[model samples]
Target: MLESLSVPKRRVAAQFVLPGGSSRKVAVFLAEAVPGREGGERLSDLLNGSGPRFIPAHDAETDAMTFVHRENLALARVAAEHEPNVVDPFNLPTEHEVELRLVDGQALHGIIAYVLPEAHSRLTDYLNSAPPFFPLLEEGGQHVVLVNKHHVAYVETLRR
Candidate 1:
């Protein structure tokens, strides 16, 4: 009876970093299917979505379920493939290479690609209008760092 009413989900492994420099390995549960996507909802979507302020995940160290506060997270690291695609068939994405310095003094270097209206396509414009949690494709494109804007001290644009 319970199985019939259960929502299908998939576990995506990730590293959760707290604002104080602590880190944990966890498995984030995501819906098995979502509208407009074939595989599942990307990690970026889950972090940036307006659905909830807490993220449900399974803690590897504790071997238990845990809910992480979105605003308290410094960044969550996941495989690049698990991140949402920035490309839009109609509008080309704007790529900016940058270094994000967090409030805790940690710096992360990556490429932030986003699609914005022609009038607001600059890096500053995109950053100002981006969701609280945004995806940053790390150098080499192997991982996606979902950074919390509230924890970011500043962003420095790098020469491409």
Candidate 2:
């Protein structure tokens, strides 16, 4: 009876690469709907939000629940549909093509969007001020990579 009182959640498949280079397939449960958002709680929200230090996920292969330390994640790949719409016209958004090199020697190329003040609008300033986990929209537009700023060795700006 008590279980019915809980908010509904849906499982979204994702791939997580740990700082040590281990990759895992897991399902993250997200709320059916967020208070102000149109759809469910996004995977980005779960990773970047200040909810907890550990994220709860279900192992895809074993079906066992596991808690991963948020800080240890190198990157998380999720479907584009799982991310919230980030195109904010009011902020005068800018998209930068970039290559993020991870500490584990893997490099990913994508476009990162940012809206910053004119005086501090460079890519360096954006990266420095961005949150720990930020979204990198993949080239093909099928996936979004939530990168851990802590694991990025350096970011090379490909194009403005």
TM-scores of the candidates in the order shown: 0.93, 0.91
Please give me the total number of clashing residue pairs in predicted model 1.
0
lDDT of 1 by residue, 61-96 (tens): 999999998778999999988886657779879988
Predicted candidate 2 versus true structure: per-residue lDDT over 1-160, tens digit per residue: 9998998999999999997778999999999998876887988889989999899999998889999998899999999988855666688687889988998899899889888888998888889998899999999989999999999999888855
Backbone clashes counted, model 2? 0
Local distance difference test values of all predictions, in order: 0.89, 0.89
Supply the TM-score for candidate 2: 0.91
Instruction: Let me know the TM-score candidate 1 reaches against the reference structure.
Output: 0.93
